[model samples]
Target: MNMAVIGMIAGMALAFAGYFGGFGAFLLVAALGAVGFVVGRFLEGDLDIGDIFRARDDRRR
Candidate 1:
């Protein structure tokens, strides 16, 4: 799916959490979504662990 669809789904999820589960659930879902996104990117090889840890000046040119 495209970014728009993904965003819509995420919004819907947050809305549901906020409506039924309250603020804490909304935050939990949002945080988990972010972690899921990062894990997905890492598994897809689109994210490099070292890139996140390395100093800015140490990055490849």
Candidate 2:
């Protein structure tokens, strides 16, 4: 629950920064969010998100 809240705040920060023309802040938060998300998945023993999401072109019998 705490992580969820923090994630929400980070997302808001990214958006808020973008609105105020703080591109660096926006990118920083986005990078943090991306890294944190990927790390969380790693801790959970999940593979890359791209691997989790199968492409339509790769769908075959």
TM-score of each: 0.89, 0.52
Supply candidate 1's per-residue lDDT for 28. 98
Residue 20 accuracy (lDDT) in model 1 = 100
RMSD (Å) of each candidate, 1 decimal:
1.2, 4.1
**What is the C-alpha local distance difference test score of candidate 2?**
0.80
Instruction: Record all residue pairs in model 1 with backbone atoms less than 3 Å apart, i.e. clashing.
Output: none
lDDT of each residue in 20-61, candidate 1, tens digit only? 999999999999999999999999999999988999889966
Candidate 2 structure quality by residue, lDDT tens digits, 1-61: 7978987888788899888868887887788888887889877988666665888677563
Best model per TM-score: 1
Model 2 clashing residue pairs (backbone) = none
